[model samples]
Target chain A: MKDTKRQTWMGLLARADAGRVPELLGQAGPSPDFEWLRAPEIGSVMVQGRTGGTGAPFNLGEMTVTRCTLRLSSGEVGHACLKGRRKGDAEAAAVVDALMQTPAETLMRSKVLGPLAEDAARARHCRAAKAAATKVDFFTMVRGED
Target chain B: MYVAVKGGERAIENAHAWLAEERRGDTDVAELDIQQIREQLSLAVNRVMAEGSLHDPDLAALAIKQARGDLIEAIFLIRAYRTTLPRFGTTKPVETAEMACDRRISATFKDVPGGQVLGPTFDYTHRLLDFKLAAEGEPVTAEQRDADPAPVPHVTEFLNRESLIEEAPRDDTPPPDLTREPLELPAARALRLQALSRADEGFTLSMAYSTQRGYARNHAFVGELRVGTVPVEMEIPELGFAVEIGEITLTECETVNQFKGSRTEPPQFTRGYGLVFGHSERKAISMALVDRALRWEELGEDNSGAPAQDAEFVLYHADNIQASGFLEHIKLPHYVDFQSELELVRKMRREANAQTREAAE
Candidate 1:
């Protein structure tokens, strides 16, 4: 797989629910040794937006986010930033991220990333279907010639 | 001759204690719970959320309670609390066109695609005092119906089909945020709308009302007014896709205004847009009117010198928090400044008297 695809899977794994990460990790078998380059820490980022949608950039507001960085014993570095205050989620994500770069890349992809990607896609489809149910197709009747 | 006043700490403490007592008035009556405030005084909570630019109803209710039922103060608390939060990321601009509307109405069309649903409104209610509420009142059951499971199409699309309205160009450029950056002028339409959306409701209402009172009147028709919930989605660069974060209730109003096109163009209908955080239709409609009034320059219309039409004046003064801060700061001690003013006045009067005496001599 391309490096970009690997990075995408790492991101999906990180954002997956903290509780779900362990189950996916268990399915992938024994974990590789890794040292915490940086433990997961919660912080905020200032969110900015353009006026209307195309105007000058302005600070809209801030939201809570958790981020972490780790390095595996095999010399692969990984990082994760997830929405909300989930420290374990960030840590687990960073570990998965590191594993994706090592020899276990294919194993992690099938047992972890693949399932995560599928779950996310399914959730999105469900929401889209719900919203689509409300879709109203409007039509205009033919009036007399102008 | 004013000396610096001191020993205000005790006074302030006593005043706070008294205020707290007042806030929980009448020992016989129970103190108002935050949940009660959130559910019962929902309109006030909506106003706070809209002006505060925060969607958390629980926080808004808490702010309201802390501020002793002062709506503006509650909004102030929400704004202050909002600044401390960490931002995840900005969602793609919410598509109000796809709103799952609970209340939808259009003045321009009687029979719209999704028929007009009044929902809960005070529009038709007579302005009569419900004295029964003065005592313990019976629970009023609401009439229920299965919600219409269809997206209500925008009323403007009809006009667009005939090319009656000016084409709103599709642009995906990010707009400026007023909260993080200082507002610069000759502001664009997007920036002005952002200011109006979070602008003080009373101030925005008056500015919009001014337009209707013949100040840069645009002959506005309420093309559509909708209150509904829209899902917020954010793009994750790692996933190479966007995900739904949550949903928020929003009030959107679009007004079609008569525009007399200039020599270079033909007459066409212009659009005024308003979108607010919660069920705040009045504020949203007011915002739309003010938004249209502010677009005079781009529309090739002559500057009418109206308060609503002046972008800088409207944007700067419309924030209640800023307005109230400056207005209330006068209550603070100003002895030094007042003393200096007194000296200057005395000095000027003495000089004038000496000149008069010299002239008489």
Candidate 2:
């Protein structure tokens, strides 16, 4: 059976190997500052095991991971990498993942990107609040007189 | 270069030293020897043996000490050791009829052939705790009964002569080991019974109890409950005969349950069997009941959809090791999955609020 996810992830791995992943993925430079950017969407990544020999029970290890980046019209960057057993599938999945982050797509925007950003914000706020509350003042207690 | 933290190794060493000191406890008090735990704390050792599928009391006691008296942890230690031990050969089926009985009871008969020997049971004991045992007591002389060399045949074998109970077919085929293999759906009687035998006693008891409470009620009578030491024999390939290797104490419970007559088949009472390591009558009895309950489908009984009736559910969740491992693993890091869910709910609520404002406007 043709596993689409495995195919997609393998494709990204191939791209990475070719040293043209950034160009094909359309990334100008390595930018970790892009908070709104969605991770690459890979289809089901095929996890292959060590081929002991021919005609042996094929062991699938883990899904190959792939991802992509995209810049939305509102300058909101998004990316997705498709993971699969094959190559071409990964590139397509990543573009689709990035496109889904656009405001124009309601289902994609609501289901995927909006929630991710909101979660990130909530986590940051919660951490900041906790840090503020735990701010300890080094003060010595007054000794009580008999 | 900027340094973050240090002294992890030193801190670990200090913590271990403190733990050792804590284990030792008060200097004045005598330390609990391994032998004392092996003999005096034998019930704990038995539990570890049954669960671990190992029989070494000394090793089990040592494991219990190392685990700080956690019986399950000791069982795990024993199981780890058991897995590493080489399997030289498989043992022949133990002959329980040849068992040197410690305790044998039959609920089916008013008096069985070999007679009911109530050896070391707390059945008729009053709730009052003996004050003598509270303090270090003296060793009392025990009276011995005249030994009977006569063998005790199974009650079901006699019933088989009259064609009253269903004849259990004896097969020489090797049974599946639950510990060695992953459990599959629609398990055979051998596999199901094997799983229940080593299953958690409390869990098995509750499941069996549920059956008695009208859920897949088999109307089971304890045909016989035998606890004794039986000789373990392994076949010598070159000699072409089985040789007695060692002896192991076993608790075997056979339940005679109510039978329904089918159109094609004769009306005969069904049997449920349970066998476990050590003097674990509770586990053995519970295992028998659950085993009988699981056989409803084969016996042409209606599906009750009870927890006991669900083979997949019972077999999968029965092991304390698997149950506790999966149950306690939730305590480990789950921030990644939680973060995903968190984001989804926040956006969903936000969207709902936005829609409500729009409607009000």
Candidate 3:
């Protein structure tokens, strides 16, 4: 897959619902042999922040994130880092990532990435519409001037 | 001649067992569920999340339940749990300007953009007690209205446009984390705010109140007090673009205080800022006041020897966990020291009596 395509899918996987990842991988079926370079492990990552959007960096806080690494039979390496403690999601994401680097790239994109992207877009749209329903516009009347 | 009291281990064990039984009192009544605490006593959960320096409501609720409604103890439990968690990459500083405000009000200006939205607040409620609420109460349905989509311009910005308020210079330096590093003396404003954010609410509130009572009075007007949710984003190194990681609810406050002018500088309104996790307006406002009081040095004003203006004193005593631990440690064994003191006093008294008798003879 192209770098842009890989980036898109990786972004989708990062934000993807953990439960949905397993269902998508199940539909994609089993892939060629692969070895886990790093099995899915639940841990945390230090969250840092700037003073403002443009200011100097500061340690904001920490958040729980899961990560995994694997290598496919075709010699392509894949890694996944996702928010929260969903081990299965990280594993499935890593497998799909590795598969994306091989001949099965097209198949993986269609089966896993495509559906997840659509779902994500739909969720965003729903939230936007809900927020819009409450949008208000305030206007002031111009007072008489001498 | 005092012998060491033994069997403390068994006594401690028995005491703990009895305490556990007391905690579960009246099994006949339905036990308070964590969910009930999370939903019904949400303010307590918010306090725990704020002072605990963690945002997980469920864990806060669980901590509250475990601590038996002692908010400070719950905060301690959450803080302890927080230390064990791993550090993820930092998010970009949350943009409060873009917050979807549920409550936004300005005391300085009666009419401002994003017209005063008095979201959910207890400010207007009468202090009278409602006997009905003592039992199971009916859910309240609030009247909903469309919120203004236009970004609410801060009240201070209006003053800034005319050079009335002091310009807050933009600095890009990273702030120090009190949780990760030991707090040093003469803290920066950023570090001071971080300490105040999680400091004991009562201590901060009282300190702030002292400033209002003329200890180091800086006449303040609430420029803006807002409660809302702000999206948190993080720059992904590989992607080279920040992505929305999550959103968190926050209470933010900004106060405009009396300006100080000297030969070198023109008089301009100074600002005090406070931001904290969850809807903790009291904590946020108190934090802002204390923050301003502590800014005496930077603002080039003389410190009037106020407790709130004393940075070291405020920071030292603000941590409830530390204060409680030191305060309660007196209950531990002190018999050895007491016995030594007793012997010394007796010897001094005997010597004094002998000296007095010699003088009489």
Candidate 4:
């Protein structure tokens, strides 16, 4: 798998709305029989920030994340690490990740990642639009010089 | 000198039970749910997350609910919960430049790349309480415009391009984690920043306010203040590439402070920066001011014996959890210590009386 392409799908899976991945995964088809290489575990990752926004990096804080790894019956490995404490989301995401590498990739991408990506884009647009409404544009030649 | 004191297990248990009942409050009243707190009292949740050094809205909301809306107590709850979770790894430094900004403003420059966005501000609102809100209120709505896909560059970048502001060099050295190690004073910039990031908002605000009143004033202009969500990405060894784990809302303030420059350099502007969890412009601004004040020595400016300029004074007293814990600990039984003090006072009085009587005879 290409790193950037896999990163895109993985990011989409990780940031997917809780339980949305599981529901989307079901619609794709029955998940290939898989065994847990690593069971779902709840943990945290320290978020880092740069010193002057672009300067030396520093530790800011931590946020909760859950992770799981699995292997398909035919032997392809998959891993899912995401934010928050949704075990089901982790399991479903890992399965999708594994399937994405196999011959079933096309079906999974269209049925699962496609809708998630679209919803995410819509949300991004909505937030940006709301923000755009508040932008200030200053008028020139309204002052003493004029 | 510490003695193990006797019983109160039963009373303690009863008191805890009583506290639980009191926390529930008025069975007749509809109890406020976690979701309500998370949504409606969002700023409070944001404050707890900022100071608690944890970023989980649901947990912060639950903490707020359990703490009866006492933000410091809520922060304490979140801090305690944070200790239990195993650490996975640290993330790549989040790029605030890529933030999908909800609010972006600059006091110094009216026209910036992002423009001045006042997103959901209370700045121009009349403070008079609306009577309609006292009763059942209707859902509020606002006008929306198509978002401009134009780039919203950082205002500091403009200063940097002109070489007007002092350079902030890239450093990748592992910064000291205050959670794991004790804070040693004469702390580095990174350590000080980590402490300030989770420092009590009210304390930081007061310290910043002092500087404005001329206690080591660092003539600061709000170069830019932006509120937005930024993606947090981490490298998973298994995947071999960084992935976006989540997005968190942050309020970032960058202040450009006037500098006469140090011995080695000519006159240039200095930078004071603050980034905090959630949409808290007040906290972000205050943090920027205090951050500048603490840079007195590094900036080659005289401290003038101000509290805000003293790193030890500001950092040590800035944590609400540590401050409250030590203060509240006094309420616990100190029978032995008190008894010893009482005995010494009596002995001194007795000696004084005997000495006076003998001298008179």
Candidate 5:
């Protein structure tokens, strides 16, 4: 619902520019050929691949990626680069960039970052709840007085 | 009263000194010199160069020393250093056909033009431990013959003549440098081969092994494996043409893969290629097999849904440094997330207890 186009544009630019989100904003234009930076989240890949450790093969490596740049009307730029895919991700990233830099930062935060952070928090809480449920408290009433 | 942590900087400085002391070990013990590490631990140097994507033996030696012999850490050090150094310029592609080979072999053909030369290899040597190496010893040098002047052409060139192998058209387009750019999925053959060459040897080997063991199986035969020094040329903007910048040791592999002919296509052997830094034949051969498997889609073969055939999957997760860094980062502070979870669980538990009590009553 927020203007994701602006925020995602910034992210796409940053992704294109080697994860460096730019400070100066200008007219966004078509990306050059050499923009994507391929940095994969390997820990997750390893964990996912390890689901059937005996069956799955895991590689410890990196890739060569390209990214694109776009500017929004709010004079903000966005960039994003992703792994294991092509520049088709650039369009979605451009929209997210457009929204991230708008007055809708709060809305975007609630709609996007907040949910992800909360889900992460919930996962941690579930682990803690499981651990805490195992806790034992011993109590004994005095026998003599009555 | 508890004191404020005013000496944080000093504490850091002292901790670094103590760490350095620990790294150096006892003062009485003979120090491991950089040259000693470079010469004695040459395989470590090759790995650092391969993974670091740099060719400086001295720098690799220094990184190995700094990293306390942890090869992966040494590679990380080398890579970080490589990133900081100013790029004077990139070299023109090395001419593989003009290589002065120290070692060359062909599994596809026993007798090929230029004759198969196994110049230096440990392939046939027995693995029995030799106790004579325990003490300082000098190896007897084999008599040297004056090497031939003519450049040995590549074995693939012969296959290209008859069109037995797929046409690997030479392109002048500049290939992407993986270090300078992030990796993307669905990479071209050039990009995939580039990543695999510098990928971790063990990782590359296992991935290649997996393909052979039926995962995205692409039957591959080593067309050729050659190790030698090749001239590296770079074009000077001032000169307007390319000139030899230097020469570097490289291991190049070409695999002849079974090409399943399509209705529109003819039956011909396809190629899987790998070229890597140093005398690393095993790494290069493995890389070639994986490279061919990754080419299934481009070649119009049926998508086997195998791991090796998935270029997106293979290229995205091949670097050990990236893998290790992310894997180790879980050790960093996450107490903030932990605290939030703590509150949520406490609230949930209290509400659950109340509901249970009410239900019992």
Candidate 6:
């Protein structure tokens, strides 16, 4: 499916550092009352891979993922599927996801998702930089055999 | 002929109590934290993730600590934990081409499009131990440079373009689940690869080494090896779209093996592939070689009667869990089985003695 606004925020929230989302969401302002459509539940998703990394698909294994669904008092439903068994993170993510559709969308986006995305980007860049330093640059040298 | 045996509950409980005490050896010393094991002993965590077939670093670390650094025991814990988790369907197959590679190398070419990024590797490190590390090692930082953000194409694709390497056919068939389905022989490549990915590292390594030593040798070269992180996306039924659940570190190895002309096909380069969770370069490479060795029959080459070429033997013995279970169970109480053997031996001895006495008389 195409990357929508909900998709972007959901991905960011899922990939956020463990337990970091709730702490951030706590400071994002007053907690809007929301009902648990589906309580925070832990499960596993069977991760699949392609044969030869490009051909036929195969099941590699499974990883832990926690997901939850919530509905705001204003009636917008939100869902979250994140890695690992961080119940608090899932609850916070689902709340933020629902709030993103409400009038407080701008407030939540700026306060919560914005910082999370920045942190993820910085981490990515740091890893890439370290890897880039290791890139091998081969040069032809004068050899007696040559 | 079966009877219930009891009355060892107290002894069993005492033994476990003793085991727990040993697990926390020397209370004076600082207790090893899960984060320490997860970070400092990252390789162990990687091995557990690969063989345990689960991708939780924290859980693997906790298992290692609980098992007292015994990796196989830790894997057993992880395997048991996975059985309890409700599976929330399979994700869309990860795209390696879109992986954000930290390390990528190709042996077939001097320089590839993405360049050979060595990443964090111990290949060039000296074997000498750093004695200072025994005390407290200083924090170290890796050198940094601007990274080129581009997809590193698979090296074999270059050969495929020119018809020099056999093509890997695209199949839409959903692969058989290794955990759910009973393992049957003459397995498909997908199933074989799945088993190999989670196979015992030592067993897979030895099998791969056999090929190097001319047991069904195929003149293999590392076409490409990449270690990187890729986003794992799952399609949500409620949303009618896929959402990125998380990312996992992967080690992928592609071995280009030399294939002579068969009766049906022309001479061309064949491929052996491996993909595993976490950064396990050695295991990935070993898996690739063994994968190639197992393809002899499918590739129309002579079977050569090698152990690595025998799919049944390789697949059956590859799992450490099954092998460990059967081997470890022998130590358990088996009085009936042992007593029956003893009685048979004694009866034969008595009969032999009577016959000897009669002859002498």
Best-performing candidate as measured by lDDT: 6
Interface RMSD of each: 6.8, 27.3, 5.0, 1.5, 24.9, 1.3
Q: How well is each residue in B158-241 modelled by candidate 6, as lDDT tens digits?
A: 889989888877777899988999989879989999999999999999999999999999989999999999999999999999
lDDT of 5 by residue, A78-117 (tens): 4443322234544345444455667755655555444434
State every prediction's TM-score relative to the real structure.
0.75, 0.66, 0.80, 0.96, 0.67, 0.97
Indicate the residue-level lDDT of B95 in model 4.
Answer: 93
By TM-score, the best candidate is 6
Runs in model 2 deviating more than 4 A are A1-146, B1-23
What ordering of candidates by DockQ runs from best to worst?
6, 4, 3, 1, 5, 2
Worst 10 residues of 4 chain A by lDDT: A137-146
Could you give candidate 6's per-residue lDDT for residues A33-144 as a string of tens digits? 9999899999999898898877899889889999999999999998999888889999999999999999988988889999998999898888888989999988898889
Q: Where does candidate 5 stray beyond 4 Å?
A: A1-146, B1-15, B348-361
DockQ of 3: 0.21
Give the winner by DockQ: 3 or 6: 6
Instruction: Kindly list the per-residue Cα lDDT of model 2 for residues B45-151, writing each as its tens digit.
Output: 87787777666666778888887797877877877776654344455566676666667778887556766666556667897989998898788743444354344
Q: Per-residue lDDT of B1-361 in model 4, one digit per residue for the tens?
A: 9998778999999999998889999999999999899999899989999999988899999999999888999999999999999999999999998998988999998767778999878888999899998899889877789886444888988888989998778788888899889999889988888898899999999999999999998888999999998888999887678988878899999999999988977899998989998988898999889988999888789869999999999999999999999999999888899999999999999999999999999
B210-328 in candidate 1: lDDT tens per residue? 99999988888998888876655556555456544344677878899998798776898888887787789999899889988998888899888988888889999999999999999
lDDT score, candidate 6, position B32 = 98
For candidate 6, give the lDDT of residue B119. 92
Q: Please say which candidate is ahead in lDDT: 1 or 2.
A: 1
Mark the 10 consecutive residues where model 5 chain B has the least summed lDDT: B238-247
Query: Interface RMSD, candidate 1?
Result: 6.8
Model 3 segments more than 4 A misplaced? A1-146, B1-6, B148-151, B237-241, B352-361
